[model samples]
Each structure stands twice: as C-alpha cells, then as structure tokens.
Target chain A: MKLRRSERMVVISNYLINNPYKLTSLNTFAEKYEAAKSSISEDIAIIKKAFEESGIGEIETVTGASGGVIFTPGISEEEARSVIEDLRDSMSESNRILPGGYIYLSDLLSTPRILQSVGRIIANAFKGNKIDAVMTVATKGVPLANAVANILNVPFVIVRRDLKITEGSTVSVNYASGSSDRIEKMFLSKRSLKPNSRVLIVDDFLKGGGTISGMVSLLTEFDSTLVGVAVFAENAQEKRDRMNYKSLLKVSEIDVKSNHVKVELGNIFDK
Target chain B: MKLRRSERMVVISNYLINNPYKLTSLNTFAEKYEAAKSSISEDIAIIKKAFEESGIGEIETVTGASGGVIFTPGISEEEARSVIEDLRDSMSESNRILPGGYIYLSDLLSTPRILQSVGRIIANAFKGNKIDAVMTVATKGVPLANAVANILNVPFVIVRRDLKITEGSTVSVNYASGSSDRIEKMFLSKRSLKPNSRVLIVDDFLKGGGTISGMVSLLTEFDSTLVGVAVFAENAQEKRDRMNYKSLLKVSEIDVKSNHVKVELGNIFDK
Candidate 1:
C-alpha cells in the first residue's frame, strides 16, 4: 500500500476518524500501510505537523517502542449541523418507520451515521454553555450521552431504572406514566451530579415528557440547573410542556392506534 | 463575542468533535458565536473549504435560512492513535477511579470520556475493514457498540439476555460460564445479522470468553465471519481456549478472592 501523500492522508484521516478509540503502535501503522516502518513514522510526523499547523486536530504519540499515534477528538459546528439535517430527513419518512404504533427508532439509533450526526448536533447545541455534565436515563440514552460527552471532554451520568450495587447510595425520583400505574423511579448516585451545576439532559425518544421531567427533578434534587433537553425525536404536536427543548425530528403524532405516524424536522434554528 | 478566525474554528471544532451526533444550523452557530450572521457564514465557508482542500474533513451546508454547516464525518489514523494515547495517560491515574473487588467497568462504560476513548481505540483497530456491523450484549456493551458503530458508519446490534420483546422471535445460543454452573442463553434477532457478513464483537469485560464464544456461535448460525473481538479490559492471566483478542487494558487476575488489583495497558498491539 504505497500511497501518495494525499492518498495517505485520506487513508490515515479516515482510519483515525473511524477508530477514535485506541492508540496504535508504529508497527500497527506500518502493518496497515504496508510500508516501511520508517516511512510510516515519517508520514505520521507530517500528518501531525499538518494537523497542528492547521489547528483542526492534534496528534499524541506514546514514548517507547509499544507507543503509537492518536487523533485528538473533535468535529466542527458546520459538520454537526449537516448530520442533524440528514436525520431530520430520515425521521420525516414516518410512514416507513411507524410499525405497530411504535416509532422504529431502533433502526435509526442503531445506524452509525444517524447516531454520529445526532450526537454532534447535540454537542454543538450545548457548546460553551459551561455544561458540567451530560445525563441520560439507562439503556438507549447511553449512546447519545457518550457521543456528546466525548466532544465536550466531560463525564456522562446515567440515571438507572433499577439500582446497581456499583453506583452506591442512590437518589431516586418517581414519574407518572401510562404503562405503569404506579410511579416509576429513576436513580442516580448522590455524588454523581454536582450541586448548582449546569446539566444537559439527552434521550433517544420522548413519548411523554414524564421521564425527562423526572430527570429534571432528580437534577434539581442535586441542585443542578437544567440547561436544556435534547431528544432524537419529539411528539411536539401533542404539546408537551417545559421550555428549552430541541429535537432532531418532531413527530406530530397522527394516530398511534391506527399505526399512523407523521414526522418533520423540528425548528432546529429556534433557540 | 469578537473571536478570531482560529478561535472560532477551535470552539466550533471542539464542540463538533465532542458531540459527533447531529447537525447544527447557521443560525445556531450565529447564536453560539454571537457574531454577525454574515461573518459567521464567511468563517464557516473558509473552514469548510480548508477541510475539503486539505482532505482532512468535509463541511456540508444546507441552503435556506434554517440551514447551517456540518463536518462530514471523518478522521485520520494518526488522529485516532493520538487520542488513544492521551486517553491512556488520563486513565493511568489510580486515584481518580475507585477500585473494587471486581473490576467495575460499569463506571467507565457509563462515563463519556472513557467510553469515547475506548470507541476511538476500537474504531482504529478495525478501520477500512469490511465490517458491516458491530455487535455487543445488553447493558454495558451498548455504549461501546454505539461508539464503534458511530465511527465505522455501520449498525450496532444488541443481543439480549431475555426474550423481552413478545412480538418478535429470536435466535438463541448457549454459553458455558466461569462463574455459573448453568449455561447462559444469548439471544439475537433472526434478521439482525445477515449471512456471510463481517462482524466486530465487543464487550465491556472479558473474563472466561464464554460470552464471546457464545456470540461466535450466534455469528456462525448466520454464516457471518468474526472480523475481530475486542474488550475494554481482559483478565489475561486466567487462560482459556480463546486467544488472539484485543484489549484496551489488561488485568492479570490476583485470584478471584484476593484484594489485589493489577491493572496495566492491554497489549492491543500484540495482535
């Protein structure tokens, strides 16, 4: 794989962008590029210099023979917005997704493009808001929380439906819901969220505002401020309460029982 | 609010890099920057052009007043490795993260920084391969799957422990565990994975390889090939039939009952 400099950069950038997780050894790069180890090292130096000079990325190298290279974490606001717009289009195809009264976000959530796009958009939305932490309910929300937290360089806290031994001394809040007659309790560690801190709540779907509302209460219990709530999709025509909300797709529910569904991109520009 | 061009790019790139999920509007950008809408637009055009010309990134803009910019989802190998090395240092601290009798990666999995770092590492490991999908079991594995899937632009399939969905039938397999006498059942959707596709298997921790071994069986059922198996942490001293695995961290078990925790960086490059 003796690639030209431009070709090498494309290959190298795509590799770093695609991986985003582990540091690679020089040997690993040499192996991937199928070039001499020295050449690979030189290419990496060039790439690192290019990244530093451009101010678009950073390269970190581990000392010793076992050490490798990594791309510093980042994406631009423009890039973030493009991702959301694509999702907005995808969510607009409601007729195709609503199967048996449930919006099949499973497919969308499971897809990387949509997840990466939505993740960046939300991160951009919360950019420079002095966000102390990113919070989400357990299960599906984990992915969204992880995406936003990564770019922000902050901790992500998960509010669990059931308490685990690992979390230790949890605080709980109850929410009223249709499926369960009794109140549903969501829990987070007493030490998980800081007091008077700015928090961004993220979730995969918002059927009713109940779950998010409970999370707000939980955050308040810790004396944290709710900066805003962002959802992958929201049923806005149903008129859910509370201000400061953004959604990639707004689902103006037509008829859930008849398996009828309609969706549109939300007012993304609306502050 | 009078930020320099480089400052604006840094802020914008940092936000997009952190979030990695959705699209943001130009209006949103204007609001974030508090700059003149025209100025913001010009800055964005310059940034986008720079990214494209350098072959380092792609910036997409949507037309009309509601539209804004987005970073085309991309990264380089050097960038990926650079981030992973930084993460390795951050995670090197023994005090910041509390120790337990058993390695509780639940915290790391739930936490965004660790998860994002892990995601980039795994993503780099499998970059440019014919990986059609990413697979992991429920709970802890979801976040990692999401991270890897996001970078790879693929789908992440979750294998459930139980048949919670009454509507759909599942394909199940049995696994022998190091802890329990009984064989555990791992369920996946019949349609979730296609035939002869390359799959990447990831998990929060690898103890006995029972789960990974089970997932291999499920993949076999669908005629899919195992592109790779990665673990956030691997208890390597405890030997098993399974070999050739990639891990972010390595733990040589200090006996199942001892109060010793020996944690070191996994030999990810050993592969």
Candidate 2:
C-alpha cells in the first residue's frame, strides 16, 4: 500500500470525497501509505488548501487524541445559484409542460451529473445539520432523496402511496392528495427508519405541500424529527398555506394555452 | 484555478472519479488547471497508475487528434465477491423475511455506500456494452436503477404499476405478476426514453422475471435495444423460464414459517 507522496494525496482525496462527514486519523493514512505522521499531516494541509481554494469543500483537523481530520462537502453560493439558474432555464422549456400543468422532470432528475450537482446544492443548503436519514414519498422523489442521502452518507426511506407485501408491517398516514385532493393513505415500512432520527425531507416537486406534510407526519409517527424540507421545484402560483421549504426552481407561470412556462431561481438563493 | 502539480493531481482524480465512463481531453485539464498539456499527460500517467494499483478503475488514453482519456469505473473481482458475500449474509438474516417469502431489501438498497458499490459491480458486469439507459420498475427498483444509472452516467426510466397523470402519455405492457401470477400492466412514460437506445435493465429483486420481461417488451415498444439485465438479488427457488440476467445475491431458500432464509452469491460472479 506504500505510495508516493503525490499518489498518496490523490488516493486520500478520493477517500475523503467518497467518505464525507467522516473523521480519519493521520496515523491511519500514514500506516496505510507507509509514510510518517508528519508527512500525512502535510498532505492534509495541502489537500485542505486545494479543496478550499477550489470551493470543493472544507477540511478541519482536530488536535485531541480521539480526534482527526473531518471533510465536509460544500458548494459555493455562486455555484449553487448558477446550477439552479441553468435548471430553471432548462425546466422552462415548453416541451417539459405536460397537460394539467405538470412538468416532466424525469429526464433531468435521472441524469447523474445533474443529480450529483443538485445533490451537492441541496446538501449544502442543509449543511451542519444532523441528518440521520432522508425521507421522500415514492415514485418521483426516490432519486432526489437517494442523491441527498448519498451526499449525507445516510439511509433514505421511501413513503409509498400503496402498500406492498414486501414492506412487511407498515405504519400508514392519511393526507390530502395534491392532485386529486382526496384523503389518501401513505405507507412507510415499519423497519425502514429508526426512532429519534433527524431526517431531511427531499422531493422532486412541491405543489400543494400535502406530500411533504404527509412525510412530516410519518416522521412523527416514527418518533423522528424533521431537519428541513427541500424540493427541486415549486409551483409559485399554487396557493399553499403555512409550509416552508427550500426549492431550487420556482415555476412562476405556466400558460398551457400559449405553451409558455416562466421559471426563476427559487428561494434557496435568497439571503 | 492554477494549482501545484500535487494539488492538480488530487483535483483531476476527483473529477475523473466523479465523471466515470466519460472521455476528457488532456487539453481540457491543461486549460482548466492552466498547466501544459505534457504536464497534464504526466499527471494522468501517475493517476492511471494510482487508480489501477488502488483498484479504483481504469483510465484509457485514446490516441489521435480526437482522442482523450476515458475513465471506466471498475472493481476487483475479489472486492466484488466480498461485497456480494457480505450482502448475502445480511440477506440471510431471519428478520428480513416478511409474509409470503419476500425479503425486505429497502435498507440495503437505500444506503448510499452499498448502492454505490452495487452500482459499480452491476455496471462492471455489463462494461463492454453500449448502454444508453437503465430501466426498472417503480418504487422498489427505482433506487437500484438510479444507482446503476449513476455509475453509467446515463438516464434511468421507471416503469410504474399504476398510471400517474404527471407521466403524460405512456406505453403500457402486460406481464404476469410474479407474486400473484395474475396479468398486470406496467407503464413507462413516452418521453422518459428515446427510441433506439441500448438499455440495461436493473431491479432490486428478480422473482418471476415478469417485470423484467415487461420492461424488455416496453423497450422493444419504444424501438430500443436491450443490452443486458442485472439485479441486486434473484429468487433461486422460483420456477422461472429461461432468462439471462446477472444478480449479486441469490435467495436459495425462504422459509417464512421458521423465519430462516438462505442466500448465496448470485450469478454475477459466474465466469
């Protein structure tokens, strides 16, 4: 496992990037790479400088015996805003507008590059929070939740509209469906989430906020706490009451007749 | 963005790891880091050696004026086997068995690290193919498909058991429901996939292969070609017709009455 200093840094940086929000001792790297602790420390110093200068993230070195260096993935405010702006423009395409005022986001959400960027932006918005798990309603929100969960290094739970036998015992909650406005039940596997989990909720789109509310209730049902709510886009014209969440794109206008959709950067960029 | 040689290697490795299955010209790196092309080439030489020695992946340099370096993510067979073995043991846990013999897999599939590893293993199984999209059924299979799609840097399309208005128009196919042995319809959004795409099918579990068949039919319906099929696990005891797919874990036995399940490494490791 002995590596040259440059190769060691490359491998160490890869490890830190893959295992974000983790603490790794310099001794461990020194032993693995067969280098001196002082050399490892120097490597960390250079890595910290490179990461910070590139706005990739930050690395903190703890001095105590039980401490080590921790890497926190981050996205600069400027970068986050630019990413969302690009998404907003792409989302405003007329072809994305389906009948009944729905926008087709599957294409964008399914792209890894876009998902990775969006994940970084959303995770950055909720940085410094203790997130034990990410929760999202089934179907469209799974990938978004998965992306955020990946960045956070936490498990994600999916809330399904229909119960499946494979989920085993489940707890159900009734919420007003956004599309049909009917009282509908959503189910979460009983074993999917642990109690007292601080969860961050993520979804692809926020319309009536009913789905998000249902998930919040599920959090309470599982004895978990909500850290925050984030969505890819929100319908600005929709009359929503008493719900606060961060969205990357705001769909300000959707004229189905003229095939025109107006989109702007969402409130995540607001100071 | 001009960084020292050591720092540049770290950032370039990060970029390559994040953007696998992508071709990037040395000129791009040279321009981005404000370094000479020869220096960037030297950096890649070190990175390629580091990556190969660490089992990270392979960096192939394509020659000619239109040539560049393409990073193909890979895992050592030993590591892949060990990962699947660990999953096999975990899947064999008695508590994973639900009613009817279905094993709960949400926890494993939802974990980012596990998904990333599984994604790499599954993607590596079909490494030589030209896969344009990863296809799977909704809810349970979305994350698995997303994981594979992320590794491949392609879009994933989810086929739903029930239709949603948000999906716009969809192409529906009838397949025998594996659990109930009843005919059911699955729908894929018309816009979700393009025609003539070479798709790789992935799912959380393969029971009767009906769902995979449905997706295959849908692929044909969309004028797309099937590159291959991969699953996180497959039911070995299920009496299935001839189906060619790679699975990481095989469920040899599921004794619901005694709450015991037997799992082994699946066909993914088969030569």
Candidate 3:
C-alpha cells in the first residue's frame, strides 16, 4: 500500500470521495500507506485545497483522541444550476408528454449520471442539516432515494404502497394518493427507523402532495422528525395545500392535446 | 482553475473515480488545470500505479486521435470475498428469518456504505462484459441495480410487477411467482431500453429463477442480448432447475421454527 506523495494523494482523495461524511484517523492512512502521521496531515492539507477549489467537497480535521478528517460532499451553485437547466430542457420535449399528460421521467431518473447529479443538487440544498435517513416510496423513488443516500452517507427507507411478506412488522398510515385523491395505506418496516430519528423525505415527482404528507405522518408514527422534503419534479398546475418542500424541476403545463410540456427550474434554486 | 501538480492529480483522480469506464483525453485535463499534456500523462501514470496497487481499478491508455484514458472499476479477489463474507454473516442472523421462512434483507440493501461495497463487488464480477444496462424488478431490486449501474456508469431499467402511468407504454411478459407457483406478469417500458442492448440482469434474491427467466425473455422480446445474471443472494433449498448466474451469498436454509438462516459465500467465489 506504500505510494509516492503524488500516488498517495490520488488514493487518499479517492477514499474520501467514496466515503463521504466519514471520519478516518490520520494514523489509519499513515499506517496503510507506510507514511508518517505528519506526512498524512500534509496530504490532507493538499487534498483539502484541491477538493475545495474543485468544488468536490470540504475536508474538516478534528483534533483530540477521536480526531479525524470528515469529507462532506458538495456541489457548486453554478454546476447545480447547469445540471437543472439540462434537466429542464430534457423534460420540455413534446415526446415526454404521455397520453394522460404524465411526463415520462423514468428514462431520466433511472440514468446513473442524471441520478447522481440530481442527488448532489438535492443533497447540497440541505447541506447543513443533520440527516439520519432518506425516505421515499417504492418503484420510481427508489433510485432517487438511493442516490441521495449515497451522497449523504445515510440509509434510505422505502415506504411501500402495498404490504409485502418480506418486510417484518410494519407501521401503516393512510394517505391520499396523488391524483387519485383516494386514501391509500403506506407501510414502513417498524425496524427501519429508530425513534426520534431525523429523516429527509424524497420522491420522484410531486402532484397532489398527498404522498409526501403521508410520509410526514408516518414519521410522526415512528416518533421521527422530518428534516425536509425534496422531489425530482413538481406539477405547478396541481392545486393542493402548499407544503414546504424543494423540487429540482417545476412542470408548469402539460398539454396533452398539443403534445407539449413546459418545465422550469424548481423552487430549490430560489435564492 | 489552475492548480499545482498535487491538486491537479487529486481532482483528476476524483473525476476518473466518479466517471468510471469513461474516456477523458489528457488535453481536457491539461486545459482545465492549465497544465501541459505531458504533465497530465505523468499524473495518470502515478494514478494508474496507485489504483492498481490499491485494487481501485485499471486505467487503460488509448492512444491516437481518440486518445485518452478509460478507468475500469475493479476489486481484488480478497476484497470481494471479504465483502461477501460480511454479507453472509449479516444474512445469517437468526432474527432475519421472517414468518414462512422469508429472510428480511431490507436493512442491508438500504445502507449506502453496504450498497456501494456490494455494487463494486458485483460490478467487478462482470468487469469484462459489455453491459449496456442493468435490468431488475421493482422495489427491492431497484437499489441493487442502481448501485451496480453507478459503478458501471450505465442506466438501470426497472421491470415492474404492476404498471404505473408514468412508465408510458410497456412490453409485458408472464412468469411464475417464486414459492407461490402462481403466474404473474412483469412489464418494462418500451423506451426504457434500446434494441440490441447487452443487458445484465440483477435482482435482490434468487428464488425459483422464474423472475430472471422472465427478464431474459423480455430482453429477447426487445431484441437485446443477455450478458449475464447476478443476484444478491439465492435460496439453496428452493428446488429449481440450475441456471447460469452469479450470487454473492447462498442461503442454504431458512428455518422459521428455529428462527435461523444459514448463509454462505456463493458460486461467484468459485475458482
């Protein structure tokens, strides 16, 4: 594992990139690379400068017996805006407008590059908050939640619309389905979230806001606090009680007759 | 955004790590960091050495007009075995056995750190294959597919048991549900995958092998080729015809009465 100064920094930065929100003692790196603690410290200093300048993230060093460096993943505002702009443009395509006016986003959401960028943007929006887990509904929301969770270095809990035998004991709550407005039970494994935990709710798209509200109530059932809510897209035309949340894209209009869709950057970009 | 050699190396390695299997020309880095192509070449040389030594991945240099470096993510056999061993131990927990002998696996699959490790291991298993997409069923398989797709830098297409309006027009296939032996239909969006794609079928668990078979058929329906099949775990007790696949863990027994499950490293480790 011994590497030259240049090689060492490359591997060390790679480590920090993969392991965000983690604290690793200088001794660990020093021993792994057969370098002195002072050498590792100097390496961290150079890495910190590179990461901050590149907008990769910030590296904070802690002093004391339990001291270590923590990597916090981040994205520059310019890069975030650029990513959203691209998404907005992609979403505005007339072909994305489906028969029922539902925009086809599976193609975008399932792409790893898109998911990773969206994850960084959404996770950066709530950078200062202490998030325990990312929560989302099954199917479409799973990849989005996983992306955010990867960046935040937290677990993701899926709220299922249907009961599955694989899930042990679960806590269920009825929430109105988005456009249907029909009350539907959402289930969360009882063991998934601990009591008094702080969670961020994430979803693929927002319409009636019912699904988000349902997840908020489920948080209450588990005695967990809602850190915040973020969605990939929100329908501006959907008339529903305004709940505080962030979205990467806002679909102002979906014209099924004309096969047109108007998309704009969501409220998350608001200064 | 000019940086010193140390800083440039850090950011370049970060980019290669995040964008694996992508070819980035030295000229791009040279222009970005205000360095010469020779300097960037030296940086890649050092990085390639470090990456190989640490089992991070391989950095292949393609020379000529389309010249650049392509990073292929990899893991040492030791590292992959260690990861599967940890998963095996986790899966063997007595409390993981749910009623009717179903093993609870949501917790391990949802944790970002675990998911990332599993992704690297699984992606490493198929390092030489040309995987255009990672295909899996909805819900439980989504996170695993996302993880592998992230490492491979490919899109993951979710095949759903129940169709959603947002998926648009989809192609459907019938399969027998594991354990239940009841026939069920799985759907994949027509636009989700392109024709003649080389797809890698991934799933959370392998039961009766019906789901994988169905996905394979769907790949045929789409005129795509099946590169391979990889599952997180497989049930050894399930009496089903043997098939070609790779699994991280093999569950030999799940005894509900004793509340015990036996898990071992799977065939992926076989010499």
Candidate 4:
C-alpha cells in the first residue's frame, strides 16, 4: 500500500534490516510501495546514513541495471567491548563454576538477547570475508552458530558426534578427546555442505582445540576452505595446540577448590 | 547520535525490530537521539502505523510513570499462507525422501531465511501465550527451538538423549523410541530451566510424537507448564498416539521405491 514518506521510510528500513546481505532492485521497493524509483533511492540514502551513524551496519548500493542495496551488519567497537565486558562480569560469578572446572555457559548461550549481541560481535569481527556457511558441533554450539549464521545470512552445518539414519550418506572423521585420552569420531551429513564453499568455524567453548581441529579436517574432506575460527569463550588454563582464533571471553582462572573464577575480554578485542 | 526526523525514525525502527517483546520508555530514545519526548512519541506513532500497515507486528503503548512501548512481532495470514505454501512445494520434491521414508530437511532448517520465517509463523501462532522458554530435543530440533525462542525473546532448553558432564546435574526421563520399540532416556540440565516456567515445545518433524511426549514429561519433572507444541512437518502415515499440536506441513505420502513424496500445507492454516 502507498504510504507517507516517513512511514514508507520506516517500512523500507525494516525490509533492509531483515534482509541484510540481499540485493533488491529499487524498482522492487518502488513497485511494492507504489512510489517512484527515485523516491525509493532517496529513502535508501537516508537509511544508509542512519544505519552507519548508529553503527548497526553498513549499506552498500550497487549501481547498474540490476543493482539495488546490500546491508552488511556491523557493531561499533564501543558497543562490542561493552557487550563483551558485561558477559565477562557474568562469567566471573563463582557459582558458575562446576565440577571438572567447567564454567556454566548454557544459560548465557541460550538467552536470545545475549545470543544476538554475541552474534553481531562475532560476525563483525570477521568482516570483509566471503563466508558461505557457519560450522559448529551439535548440542551446545547450535544456538551460537545459528545466531552468527542469522547475522551473516548464511546456512549453518552441524557436525555430529554420532551417526543418524536420517542423514542418509555421511562423512566421518576422528579427533583426540579432550577429557579422555581416547580418540572420538565426528560426522557431518554429506549434503549439508557444498564443495568449495568458504566456512567459518564457531563453537561454544575452546578447551583442547580438538573439536575445532577435527572440524578443520572435515572442511578439507568436503573440499571447502576455512575462513576463520571463533569461539564464545576459551579456557586459558588448558594447554592445547596453537591455532589462530578469536574469542569473546577468556576464562583466566578457574579454581574449583576455592570456588573462584576470573573472566576477561577475549582476543577479539586485541589489536 | 542526533539525526533528522527521517533518519531518527529509521534507527528507532531498527531498535524496535531487534528488540521485540521489550518495553523502552520514550525518555530513553529521547535522551539517545537528543530529541524531545514529544518528537520521540511522534516517531513511535508513525512507526506503529507503518508496522501495522505492513503486517510486521503490533505496537502496544503502556502509559504510566514507568511505561513505554512494546512490539509484538506478527505476520499477516496472507503472507503466512504464501510462505507455508512455498515450503509445502519444496517439501514435495521427491529427492527429499530417504531410504526408510525419512525426509531430508537439514537444508531448509539450516538456511537462515527459512528458519526466520518459520520462527515468525510458529511464534505468531502462540502469540497470546506467556512463553518463558522454547523446549526441544537435541541433534535436529535445536535450530527450530532456537528460531522460535529468538522470536519470542526467551531462553530455550534442549533435552539430550545422552548424558554429558558439561551439563552438570540433570533430570532424566524415559520414553518409547519411535524407531526402536525399546524405551529411551532423555535428560535436561537441572539449572537450565527454573521452576514454574511456561514453555513452548518445538521440533523439526512429528512422526510417532514420542520425542515431543518425552519432552513434555521432562517439563513436568521441572515443574514447568506446557504452553503449546509446534512442528515443522508431520508424517501422515505414522500411527501414533493422539496429540494436539500445530504443524506447518504434512507428508501425506512417501514412497521410497518410486522416489516420490507428497506434501501439503499442515494444520497450521486450518480453521
């Protein structure tokens, strides 16, 4: 339906925000709102300014017969640091320390608000990379991967620890178990990922780095390339394989005897 | 940042869309945007009209000493039907059939675009219910639950088929397995959910309804109330105990030998 300029601007802003990284011709919006293409272009100009100024994201306009606009979601450094600091404070609570030095993170991972903010921060940290999919292990990593995938506007593939009949054909790999010295297997559906796609690996926690390394091998088997690795939190005490990665929070200390846990901003903020 | 009326409206629209089911007083926006309270109120008025006109959602204004506006995400019936119809067509593709009459839905579930639409549709169906969390079984149902919980702005609890030490203490329940006639156990972390929370159960597909039932019983152990149940699709041929729930698609027929499958809009659109 036709609307006033202000109302039309509001609706178009909603569309761009929801359909980030998508290219829509100005004519499409013009026809949908029953306005001139020139008017639609003007509305986008204003939206671009608003989105950039607020650090919500960046809007790129393509100029061609088939071009429109694309939104790359971003978070300001200030906002990102503030969000991670708040998470660090929550992670430091002594009550979150459980047996085996595991910090309880399920509550933070499952909450929508925290998940969305973490998603934006992670996605922004990987800016300028052409990522086609987000990869994570089953169970704990699903929501974190989902959140980041939602922001990147890409499909996410889950690597499972067990084989299921519903997955049809599958690809399997083995990695060293962190807690136990035994080797463990991980599986991914053959069709879940496409060959030659660039993938960003994400996880809820980083301990031995075994799981992430296992996923890296799976990527090679799929004939895909790894864009980078990101984790929600990392255990600094654990000595693992040295790998380049970014994390939102670092568990600097976890003393089970004293029931003490220390948390700080992760490598994502490191220059 | 201070902005013009049009640009400010664009930013405010972004805030409301990102933060649905949340209340923010005009003073907050007034202070942030460096605009008068009256101007901020006017911005919300225009936004409400635009949002309703486009069927994005409803904006409720709670007026009092400590009140502001709340956005309830919504989808128009016409749009919802169109989306469901498209999914029905995609589900009918014969290649989706597996050896044992299972449907391959990982592609659809993993895609952010489709999951977001399904989330809006499912969350909209249970609009009036006070949902404290979304519940589902692990491996397959995690993304579906995450989608719904994201829309509803609540945490989600996942019931696992196997025990993990990372979950700390958990409550386990037994249910009849659909594939195998043997009883299977499912577990939920003790601290993941609080007592007396109202939850909505979501899953990728419904066959024997055993898994959903398992989760429902698990809820009782936690002293949580069931708000409702929704599924992405249901198997029409499966003979199972009767249960009340909403489904987006129905697999009317699946012939593995002929490599044919029939799908149609589910009971979600039924009057």
- Pairs that clash in candidate 2: none
lDDT of 1 by residue, A1-271 (tens): 5554434444565455435445878887677656777877776776665455543456788878778886664445455556666766665564543334555555667776566556657766665477878889877787778777765556788888886665656899899653435688889877677788888999987866788988999987998898888887777655456556788777776565655666767655575
TM-score, second chain, candidate 3? 0.98
Q: Quote the RMSD, in angstroms, for model 4.
A: 1.1
Give the TM-score (vs. native) of candidate 3: 0.99
Instruction: Kindly list the per-residue Cα lDDT of model 2 for residues B1-271, writing each as its tens digit.
Output: 8999988988899889989889899999999999999999999999999999888889999989988899998899988988888898889889998888888888998999999999999999998999999999988888898989888989899899999888899999999886656999999999999999999999888888888888999998999999999988888888877989998988888898989999988988888
Worst 10 residues of 2 chain B by lDDT: B172-181
Error of 4 at B69 (Å): 0.4
Can you tell me which runs of candidate 1 are displaced by over 4 Å? A1-85, A92-100, A166-169, A189-192, A237-244, A254-259, B1-100, B110-117, B162-170, B176-178, B189-192, B237-243, B254-259
Best by lDDT: 4
lDDT of 1 by residue, B78-103 (tens): 66556556545544444323334344
- Candidate 2 matches the true fold with a TM-score of 0.98
- Candidate ordering by DockQ (highest first): 3, 4, 2, 1
Q: Which ten residues in a row are the worst by lDDT in model 3 chain A?
A: A175-184
- Every candidate's DockQ is 0.17, 0.84, 0.93, 0.89
Candidate 2 error regions (>4 Å) = none
Candidate maximizing DockQ: 3
How would the candidate models be sorted by TM-score, starting from the highest? Answer: 3, 4, 2, 1
Q: Which stretches of candidate 3 lie over 4 Å from their true place?
A: none
Candidate 1, residue A212: CA error in Å? 1.1
> For model 3, how does the per-residue alpha-carbon lDDT over A1-271 read when each residue is reduced to its tens digit?
7789989998899999999999999999999999999999999999999999999999999999999999999999999999999999999999998888899999899899999999999899999999999999997899999999999999999999999999999999999885664888999999899999899999988999999999999999999999999999999999877699999999999889988899999999788
